[model samples]
Target chain A: MSRHRTTRQRGSSANMLMTASASAGDDHSDSAQDPLPSWNEGATKQAIIDFVADVTREDSPHFEPRDRRIAVFDNDGTLWVEQPMYAQMDFALEELRKVLPLHPEWRDRQPFKAAIEADFETLLKEGARNLQILVGALYAGTTPDQFDRLAAEWLAAAVHPRFERRYTELVYQPMREVMAYFRANGFKTFIVTGGGAEFVRAFAEQTYDAPPEEVIGSGIITRFESRDGRADLYRFADVDFVDEGPGKPVGIESHIGRRPIAAFGNSDGDLEMLEYTTGASGRRLGLIVRHTDAAREYAYDKGSPVGHLERALEGASSNGWIIADMRRDWRVIFPFDGA
Target chain B: MSRHRTTRQRGSSANMLMTASASAGDDHSDSAQDPLPSWNEGATKQAIIDFVADVTREDSPHFEPRDRRIAVFDNDGTLWVEQPMYAQMDFALEELRKVLPLHPEWRDRQPFKAAIEADFETLLKEGARNLQILVGALYAGTTPDQFDRLAAEWLAAAVHPRFERRYTELVYQPMREVMAYFRANGFKTFIVTGGGAEFVRAFAEQTYDAPPEEVIGSGIITRFESRDGRADLYRFADVDFVDEGPGKPVGIESHIGRRPIAAFGNSDGDLEMLEYTTGASGRRLGLIVRHTDAAREYAYDKGSPVGHLERALEGASSNGWIIADMRRDWRVIFPFDGA
Candidate 1:
């Protein structure tokens, strides 16, 4: 039998007692018994176990449907490599180079000029407004379907310069296991991110096993109408809504209609989501995946220009949010060869 | 057995199934086996049936847990009476008269002046914006808990002008039956409305049996923090977000991560929510409650001064949305005096 099926069989038999007394240690031999063997034993692991235990115990006050145990995760740093620069920015820059011939004016525009010239510092100084402009320019005048196809194509071929691996392949294996583990336990996993909704949704299913509809993110305004005697929806660059920080909770509240019992993030961007999730009455779990291993992966946190983890760390302990120490809590980082 | 249980047992085991297959020409007696005999056999009945069918059919593609089947309803025209002005508006006007002594400037304000003189025509012309201003002014400066208590007190004694019954008792019997039916089938019912979230939450459980967190609505922003060595979250009059029109979908998308397969609305404000819900790829349903019987309830659509249904009616047939024809479909409207 396959390893996962064997684990499922053992889980059904051994873990069917519906009690809260399951050992909190990582001593269980996971060879064919636990599918999540790579997770480390600590606050992060304990939080997951305790929350799931309380929710699964029929006698516990917090017991809820295994189906209602939805967990939403921020994608950028939490799921895959977002350091150096956002992986999507790299893709946009490459696409810009390819499309430069068509848009000759971009060679002279300030930020666009800097982008074409490969000046990363100038781009950073421009901040959020510039980023919005870049996103609008990259995604404008394209149908959502076409944009998805382009995004999928870019993700398949794009490689991280530092790791020299395809961007899709750089996804953290431990996090992937977490998604699978949650699904195994009857939790509906969703990707709620600040990235373009259409952009991430295009490849989320193929990469994370999360379907397109389950993905929620920032979106451009779109209009539905008939074109050429067939129904068609046209996407425009006009700002629709931004899904970040407090907006994350707002987005989740608007789209899902049910508050998630669990949330995961890696930086300050996800602080609001974790706050909202943990603030919910009853058993809740909030986790932050801290990139603290520079050797295996990148390690800068509070001082890092990208995915800064300052305010989140300040409130982590007090708020009871688990900060996953990459070097200690994760047995593996990226699924890179020889890692 | 209880009356409902006895009636259910007396009918054929396939009573509900037979009712489902019966043509629209069948009278209310066809549903004699239905546990909720108080419900009328129009759009409200169809909505309940569609939702229950989708959630209960394990073999059907739309099958889902009863717990996930959340049904939200607007209060005024949907659950109660909006004719001769909204009941809440009357309460607000009364409260304005009582609070006018504190704020002397209100005696000269246009809308408040009209309100003081019972000039409802002027108030209606001022529209929703004026109502929002009044709510902000009245609801401000008080703690959220205090406001909730005040609302509860008002709800306890407030009476509908036309019905001569407690405002809470103005709820439609057919809709109430729908609520019970949904609950029996395992659906988590909610009240997504433009009413104050905390205000409606205070009395929703007592009136409609819907729990506090399940009620989403418009309200002032509040801060969750400690104050002067005591823990207190205070509500402020700052308009946070309006739960109407496009905001309904935005609110649903943010709070609930999963898209509802079904939705119900009575006005143009609910149009976006119905659109969003029905836009989902799978088997989805949307229903518009058309108030068409002036004797049982106020019949107004298209150009009605209150809760206009022009846009909704125009698109209902094309969108495949069920239009609840109150005159032809319902056997009763309100629960009080066996209406």
Candidate 2:
């Protein structure tokens, strides 16, 4: 539920029925031989292929043992649509709506009042602070298990307004292929997100092929209590750590205990993570997913309310970061767009 | 350096020169055939063997998938020796000695002076509070990599006084065998310690065959800062979270994000971890190593200054936790005691 805000409007809706043939016509393809079939043949795709080959090849000077092959990816805009708002933000807003009846005091409060009435104008005026207040109140007293259940239930029934499909179904096909490709090469792919860890954990395994432990993100403080001879953890409203911007490096060190060889992100929130990752000695990769295809997916960068990508985009060339232009590099966006 | 204070004195020193020939005469010999050859034929060994078989057997009602077969072990006494003091406490004390000259004001400080002078009586009188002050100061501003180097260097040069062996060599051979057995059966073994995570991670991979990510423990707050275009994390004096007693379950949840099917420990610090692990539905195992072999290892369990084993020991029977008596259950205490 945490994001910056701007006045940019949502772009064109994705053509869900559009076949892979549409993108294929304008993009080069070696779908028959490529491990990343969803990716068109381009410098961006070649960078990914060549990096994997270098680290995994036994005789190569850049060869890294399997255990050291760690790769991290930012969630929101990089893996899925974050144009209208962050998916977690939408989930939090809906949660606020559901709980508004119980707390009438929320009807008069600034953030709560705007949020309860679905006033995007007032909410966007002060997004981060308002969203933090709402999310903190919404998730405060729930246990991790309770939060997981809520997230799972919400994700199951909730549909993205633009796509008219389940949020889980809106994950990028090419990113999923990239994750699978990394895993197949013995690289441990971890989803390092700015979203709540528990929220992402609910569907990370099924949606992203990442296990619960592999997903690191922002977290609420959790207290361990013994209740009726049973051990339980209660998530508190206080923020434990935020796994965004500079926190990405701290979270990676705390959770993974190793520097990732490759990092992928879509915004300035991931700038520090990419810097830490690709800055390490030896062959490394830093990739930025640029949402340039407005026809297939929403597009916004510097001025976008959510996932504003100005500084990282500008520094990509200097940092040796690959910027994957969605319109040019990807053969398909969502899985429904491909065979 | 965090531990309970007790008035009990150190137990008998281990006979490092005592060969396998001595114990082999008294213990059963099926070394070539047994997976856990260091474990004697007993109810404790059988309990571990049976639990692994039941979960791995496809026909068994208790069968669990490979990914769910998680086994966690407490580090201090369960995996290695914590006799005269906890090994981490010893490391902390040694670090204090090296840094004493740099902090002249510490010469007059109660805890610092007492620790520097090797005044065990005063240090042990108010152990937890005094040790906390010393440890907090010692590890305050160092980066994780710096801390790792300090711990690694100390561990390499440090030797256990009684056994005249390096602290790493003092690890329990029986416990090592059990870890190997679990891994061989597709179980991921993790060390859920009450000690500093960075301290354990320095040697975990080499000494215990546990990767850094698998060693969950207490941690200091870390901050990420960018210096010279490089991201670095600096450890703060403030304690982030302690992975002991009630915090064990909390740490396990934060790090592994799954319930361990099997839990192993040797003290009250692991009481809640054992409770949580064994309390879960389905096939579960909880085993505690009772340091009853004074001649082979150290044995002052119930009233020991470190690794106190009272509440957990008393509740073991009612909780269906297996108590592995070190004297009777282990054929060899350390790897040096056996082939």
Candidate 3:
């Protein structure tokens, strides 16, 4: 029951990506031209292009001044598939299992043991914090470089259970084009998420072209220590900052030192970010990605365990935030799945 | 007794900036041709060019792959004068006096009384936290927009006592040129300072061409709230993150998400950032501004009150960090004052 549903959502999952590939290979060399081919040229797509054009045009009243054209995107749901489980949570669970041989003590720990043994019911009973704990374990004492390498290796190999493609590949092609579109128009794109900052940073450049500094998210503490006459920063097993809900705006002010001109997010966790971003004085944009595609990707919104979307779904229209219906707005759900 | 001295140090304070204006008005065409005209042709200047050229060249083995090219700089002495107290501290002190009428209670408060009365000895006795407390007052209840306005206005009018020029004008012409040089060569320049992040961010784009997002510095805690349907973030009187000494590296990682390929600093606070940046794998560059121009700019190193530079002075040559001698190497000490 999306507010907008059309032929864009009619295609089956099997030919989704292949269809996109065929179009992408044909004369899409110009950076500014054909930026959103994965998009079905609907009102949503037109709105984004029009906004960017207004801001970048020299004579336009909506022209974003120097140091003001910041674009922020939420990870997990907005940019990629975050159904059944968040890809990051899935990663953390896998990492916990891999280290079971070294952490025998984890076998006796409740959350760790449940996670290691794949006890989904007990893990679910423990609630969302179980994911944080697993993430902490994933960090532990690994040097930042080591962590990056580990994440890269895992992302390259790990495949989604349902889609049978790497989680990295599940990032929506339409959204990816949107990011590039922003970049081409002089907006600096940043990833503001509740997921681990370092974890997202590991593959942000490769997956989204957003390098480390451009990616802001939840992160644990880090301490600098010199060993063998060389300095290495070690990750601590404690939360330093969280980038969800209200924290998203705080994170933006703290790290980037400016209010973003536009923001993209999904779920209640992103509501505050959407409000904060679009609420700014000048012309601003706030977009919520409503996951409504079941054939191409998992679809769930209100009351779902992962990436619950009740608040945003209700507030999007009233807030004048554009609702990106995954099934209706996007031509393709994932990189591998075409329209 | 000084380590390096030349005719550049002989000029009295009055003529420092006058000499710089003569060359600045000249046609300095070409990005690479006259990058750092304020810098006397020396090994320090050449080292910077060589490192940038090698890393930026696609064919070179030392070429940085992807978009990992980052350059970080400490603001205080590295980019601007830290002598006669930091510019940010001075702003906080001024704000304290201006607000004394509203908060008459500050007249009895220990540190606040000292700051309002211009009791430098008493303020110094109260230590660094005194400045932070005053800064919290400067930020208290003021929205981000209001804060930006106040900071911008203050910087526009605030004049350096000795130079008799706006504080914004005190930024090093040589360093500014270097930042432009970096930008010209596809490098993103960032001001990684121990100064208040918001304070520095207010003028960073105007003075350094480093946008607000590109500026990283120390910060206090902030809370998000909405009033009159307008959401604004409030600064709290508590430590959030410090960007000094070892904290610089952590700040860099947290904000930028990667190690910088090049870093510039002055004094002991920047030693860790210097080590962190230069110590990264592949070709790297680290340069420390040595304040030795006594007549043109206030000179202090190793044991002076502010910006003491002892450990870094000893480690510079050994660590292969270039020492930019203010007296001998800089043709101009400030934008107004030339060698």
- Highest-scoring model, lDDT: 2
lDDT of 1: 0.66
User: What order do you get sorting by TM-score, best first?
Assistant: 2, 3, 1
Backbone clash total, candidate 1: 22
Worst 10 residues of 3 chain B by lDDT: B1-10
DockQ of every model listed?
Answer: 0.06, 0.23, 0.29
Candidate 3 stretches greater than 4 Å from native: A1-34, A101-130, B1-32, B57-61, B101-130
DockQ versus reference, model 3: 0.29
- Please state what fraction of the native interface contacts candidate 1 reproduces: 0.01
| Strongest candidate by DockQ | 3
Better of 1 and 3 by lDDT: 3
Candidate 3 per-residue lDDT, tens place, A47-96, comes to 88778777877788988753467889999888887877777778888777
Q: Which lDDT tens digits does candidate 2 get at residues A242-312?
A: 78888898889888887899999999889989988987789999999999989999777887757878999
**Superposed Cα deviation of residue A156, candidate 2 (Å):** 1.4
Choose 1 or 2, whichever is better by DockQ.
2
TM-score: model 1 vs. ground truth: 0.67
Ranking 2 against 3 by lDDT, winner:
2
Residue-level lDDT of model 1, residues A194-252, one tens digit each, is 77777777666557765454687876666544457543345666656567766677556
Note the Cα lDDT for every prediction shown: 0.66, 0.77, 0.75
